[model samples]
Target: MSPTSASEIISALLDLTAWTVFDVDPEGRILAGNDESGSMQLVEIAPDGTRTQLTALPSRCSGRYVPGTRRVVVQHDNGGDEQMQLSLLDIEPSAPPADLPAGLPADLPTGRAARLPATLVDLTPLVHDPAYKHDLADVSAESVVFLTNRRDGVDFDVVVHDLATGAETPLYDGGGYLVDAVASHDRRSVAITTLSSRPRSTQILVAGGEIATSPTTGTTGGHGTTSETPEPHTGTARPVAVTAADEHAHHIHVAWAAGDHALVMSSDHEREFAAVVRVRSGDGVPASAETDGTVWETLVAADDHDLEVVLSPDGSAMVVGHHQDGVTTLAVHEHDGTHRCDVTLPDDGVPTVIWAPDSSRFAVHLTASGDPGSIHLVDAATGGVSTLVDGRAQIPEGLPISLPTVHRVPTPDGEQIPCFVYRPAGTARTGDENDHAPYSTTGNAAGTTVAGASVVLVHGGPEGEANRLFSPVIQALAGAGFTVLVPNVRGSAGYGKRWVSLDDVDKRLDSVADLAALRAWLPELGLDADRSALWGGSYGGYMVLAGTTMQPDLWAAGVDIVGMSSLVTFLENTSEYRRAAREREYGSLEHDRDFLVTASPITYLDQLRAPLFVIHGANDPRVPLSEAEQIAAALADRGIRHELRVYHDEGHGLAKRANRKDAYPAAVEFLTEILGR
Candidate 1:
């Protein structure tokens, strides 16, 4: 076999499609998001293996089916702006139409169409502004609970919209960044989690006449006041903090349980990891009182790893996702916390589980490094797992796909950075002239050898973890004969709260130092230090620019996608609602302006030596396109080798298949040429 070109390898990997099971209807029909039509679209899969494309909007769309109804509340946004709008789509499977075209207009009429079986009704025109986001929180038979920032464009307010009367009621008008709000089964009470009180820590608030918020208050040695004014609602009752306002920083999430109870996953009680706990409102409390009696019961005790739980709608069972290292192990438990059986996954990958309406079984969406992805149906009682959707089957026969091997790189400070290494298959020349070795042959391409080069791929979020999931970019780089290293440096999540907050505020540059440490240890793994490059997007993109600028002689080339060059300018120009939230992590311009400037990659552009390729979305809301433009201009003015590509129809990242096909291949080609691969 001949050596495959970078473009050919990238294109082939990008052609693979993956779908995730979002919600399952009562009729055993699965609602999913499939990227088969060039972009992720709403899809419905019947129990008999029939798949139907629901929405064909140009932008990616996702939604949940209204409980006990054929109507689905769709959510989408324009280009890559994060202001999502809500709409209602009704599907009539019995009235199937003939030969619908591949790509339909985004603004297709609302009524029944001659070429489709779904009617899309634009709900944004009547309910909320398209300029602001109206994120769906929970949908019930009586009403829809959503959080919208339309009123002030900064604070999200919980609103309950009646499904029958079309009346919208503002349940809680608390001014803060609300994470999630869930209404009880009776819709009389609501539970919400917010980060307004403290940075990086979430406080739970229960609003209703029945349950009283906990009056416990104290400082946590962090920023902001733990005390909050009782927010008055429509009635005489107000929303109050249910969790104790103590010195410990707690990150809690809530969902409605059986009756008047709410399932809570909290990191409090002196525990380093979050644990599942059940809470409910006790009787004999006045509606206007400051303290409504509340009872708490521990369900699953905190262990060494963090836990994520999803309760079945019928309240019979729950799926517990145990987060340890970088992967998840799912287990089913009875309503009373009795362990049923641990779910056996097809591969060691990240899995997202959603319960069926009946609670008899659940759908597990599994994604691994070696395969594209697949969706499996698990029996809640027997723990039997069967494949419902297989994306691995679509891969062309004999195509090489590299699987990651977990490795830890020790830093100078003694902190070991977790990383996944993907080496090219077949024999490759080591650093020494006489040395030769054969890599793994699991996904081997015959006659292909390592290019003696490597690419360091970084994940965004600074809070996000780099797990062993299917990545076209990583696979493409490995297939092109360059080894790939995905590192979860300090400030990345999944390790614990302490690990994630290690690089906060004044310690921001420490994460970039971790990258330097990773680069220094590359030679020990038989990788060439002179041919290594940095590639990342968003915060990861910021890392790429920072690594190249801070350590000028370390990398041969760099690829930045929608990355920020200056933290000060980025925080100032970011979306208004997002500014405060991001400030908590990156530090605020109001007080830490000097530190922000010092941490910015743009501040040290004069030290940059590596050739760079910058890719950005023209309408990006998070980092802004200006971040990319400024870095590219500075590089040009300094006579540095660099290139830039801006896509007008994109936001934070490339969502469209056409743009990815164009941008990624060009980036790979640039890296190959600059590294002399």
Candidate 2:
């Protein structure tokens, strides 16, 4: 960032309001940190021209033990901007000298904001594995779940664990593709969907008391089948009532209706809300069909991602959530059309509708008249709203962590593109506190902050939309002190049709520009735009490469995690499902090769001036290891400085503890050395 005057260069540093940023030693001791973000420092110079602070940075003083081989790996982006980082020797712990009076204020994280137990910052660093798995992802009901081997050859039953206790229990032991699973109310039962390679019937498994005990499997993970009936349960199974019938009646609800009937909320997988179905539990035999049991849909144009039907315990009214571009909302329904009024969240956040067991008040997320984000519980009758929990709890202690700033940037077509940017905690625009709404402060923010450099974090799914999920990497980087920006660029979902379709086909390159604009705009907000770096995984991995390659002069370094380095290789190696579906975004390779090739980042590799690091998994079925091999081969052949980190046992993204243990350290060293901190 430049100084007060645009022309002159400033130190590109700021004093933080919360815990300071630190770089520590291998023995869990403070090395160096800025005074603003963390505690005061006690300086001690080491032989290797090193400076160690008595009080460690937030990343260093994590109050956790680190084994000799493992180090708390904190990655700073350096923003990968053009300029070199400031002097690292000057950084040390921010604590006051020991001679100072003990009467001074005591500052530390103690209450609910306390750090996770038994975990250190340097525990697992990011590695540039070229073959890391990105597809084997699971959203667990508990913060921590049991390990489920997600490889192709290894056929193993998946066991979902209890959130409080790590007691593992069987959910499904399928060999075929098991995309997702949700446990029932009693926690004893669960609903899982399995599909064969041929897109056959997506069988839903209800492991009530019946399917939990017996497990004699013969087939491999590439394919498996649910017994026509579930085996009896060994012990008492928790009774969980699932109402969601996945699209196409694949695997909807696993309820205990009519003795052992599972109620599923299903629809056609064509991304439409045509037919919603209810099936018997355990066996997927359809018990009934809604929409008047008619073949044709009343709302053909309705935008339905998945069936949002919440069936009442009495089986009378089912609250169905539907979206029709003009009107996206939830309504109470039965065999007839909607029975009650429709309820919509603010900007339609795909509301998570939780009905009381009695079905009186439908607790959901909603937008208040003048509030940025407010949670409300509505009376099912009058539709009157009452605020239950306001996320705006005054943070009397910590840093000023802001929510995502939603801006509608102007595109070439004069259309407004809604972009979400989350600034680091304790960092914000210089204005009245109340003028700016409390930022959602979602996703992940690293622990510490770099003095000058910031990272432009990218979200995967080129078609994926950003949400308020707990992100470890983002939090780690923020703890290490790097400003992060996650943009919901074109091709991302959740938006209307036009917004999502923006990155389809020839218009794909626009994502790169939208990102570059983010890079340029950061400097205007007191961040070091020129010193920023680029990092992301999956399609985000692709973006990291595109960021450095297309804007070669912009980033000082690039970190690609399970990203598509070469579209051609990715397209050639990916699964048939992905190859067919990805065409909507990149265009069908068989039909429009030229148009798809134009959006491929490999088309402009020669433009990559920044040092690049690419990581991937060997068993990635979606984007094969060949994508990394091609890019690595090209970079090596071109004599361009690069690093390739590969994980043989994983696919898409890293899952194994051993893989992350090695990978995260590599990322820290690379970012630190390149970022010059």
Candidate 3:
């Protein structure tokens, strides 16, 4: 077969549709959905892998089955504005008049195999505000708990909606923003995680809105500064000091264990990496609270990377997912955090694991370097695994796939950057180690010597991560005979928190330095430095623009997808709900304006030598469309070769399938032309 063209690869990938599993039913079936027409239609997957569409609603909705009931409580919103409403869906099959059961619970678990008429019960009347967004917290037998934020408020207040009467009541207001809330298995208490006390800080609160603290006050620790413990709450709930109240500390709720009497969470309080700790209800304050003592029970210590835990329903065992380097490592552990054994998952890819309702089995969605990916089933008892669904099932036949090879490049600053390298399928790996022969001499499958260009694919989030996953865009570039190097540069998550925060605020230029270091080391890996292009979306896009401007001659071309050109303007224009979080990552607009302007890509545009291509969604809320417009206009006026493509119906990123189908191929063509393909 001939090498796949850029257009061929795009078509093969866009032809497939991907479904993400959200909730699992008691019958061991899966609940998954895909977004269409700006709404997600929930579907039921039988044990035999057959999928049946369950709901047909006009608005976007996601449903969670009511415990022990045939009804699913759905949270939906109009036109994707995210102001969600509660609705009950009864999917029980229609029965004959004589077979009707008497006194059924207000909500019941519905049949999986039978095609039932979905009855929509509007619970939106319970919430008076039409502009407030609602997020499902916990669905209990008696009530449904959720968090709601009005247009006028910054924090989300927890509310409980009773199933029988459809009455809603306010539960708690943390004074700060609510991060997450989980009801105990027993449903007696709810564990709420909040970041209200300080910027990027975390606090855990048990039900009744109580703040648990030590009996004695004035403990010294956290930032090496002595902190006077706040007075313990004598109200319905107590605030437990899982970590010190340092402004830099961030806690993410993992799960509630020991029958809801304890909380399991991950925190980077004083450590470089994040660790998982299980805090009992009355610990008052963690030992880390006492100037010099061990932190909470230390369920799972960080091993140079971030650790995340998912406890089974019974809390007897857990799957400890460790993000080391750039890949996920799954290991089984006792509920108390003792090492049990390892559960092997696909290497060098992101794995999303979901437990069966009974916890006896788990479904892991793994996406590797090529093709879309696959969902695998794992036996909890033996760590055995099997494929449950192939994410690449819809790919056209005879399309080639490329896998990524992981390598670490050491920087002068002593940081080891992990790079995922993808050489086109037939590229020769047998070249001499000492020859220093570049990629131009590599032979393709057709046995012809091809001068392979290289492209640096940066990922977004800066705080987000770029794992080894099935990226159609990356593979398409490689299929067109280009070598792709995706680096999880500093400030990227999955690495230790300290490394992620290294590029924060004024130190951002250090990360751009890492890009120069990456390009300099390319020749050693048999890649061409002169023919390389810089490409990324979001934060990665920011890096592309910055790299070309800061290190003007390093890249042959550049692509930015909804990336910010001016950090100052971005903060002033981005969505209100995201401004605070963005400030925490990029720095404050009011006080750090000078630093932001210095770090902005636009400030250094005069140094750019690479031709550029910019893509954006007209409706982007995170980095507004104006960010792209300003940069494109500036580049045009400067007489630099550039092109800008804006999708009118898109937002923050290219989400719509049709738009991606058109945008990606065009992007490939642009890069290929500039790279001399």
> Which is the better candidate, 1 or 3, if ranked by lDDT?
1
> Cα deviation of 461 in candidate 1 (Å)?
0.6
Candidate closer to the true structure by TM-score (higher is better), 1 or 3: 1
Regions of model 3 farther than 4 Å from truth? 1-3, 34-41, 55-63, 75-87, 94-130, 195-201, 207-241, 281-295, 346-348, 431-450
Clashes of each: 2, 95, 16
588-659 per-residue lDDT for model 2 (tens digits): 678878866766778888886787778887767767778888888888888888899987766667644445
Better of 2 and 3 by TM-score: 3
Residues 1-677 of candidate 3 have per-residue lDDT tens digits of: 43255566657666565555666666767766654333357777778988777765554457776655666777765533455677766556534445448887545443432434242432324344556667777665456778877635566777666667766556565444566776555444456777633444576665553111211110000001112333433343443444455557667745766444566777776677778777652443232343454335688886677887777766677788887756677877888888877888654567776776566877776776653656677888788877666766656666767777767878998998878887775666656633434544445542122255788999998778878777878877777777889998987777776667778777889999999889988887676688889999999999998998878988899989989888899999987766776786788898899999988889998887789889998867678889999999989889999999998766667766677777887887788788864
Best by lDDT: 1
Residue 86 of model 3, lDDT score: 74
TM-score for all models, in order of appearance: 0.88, 0.50, 0.84
Range of the 10 consecutive residues with the lowest summed lDDT in candidate 2: 79-88
CA shift of 288, model 2, Å: 15
Q: Give Cα-based local distance difference scores for all models.
A: 0.75, 0.47, 0.69
- Which sections of candidate 1 miss by over 4 Å? 1-3, 93-114, 117-128, 197-199, 209-237, 244-253, 266-269, 280-297, 427-450
Candidate 3 C-alpha error for residue 389, in Å:
0.9
Local error of candidate 1 at residue 673 (angstroms): 0.5
Better of 1 and 2 by lDDT: 1
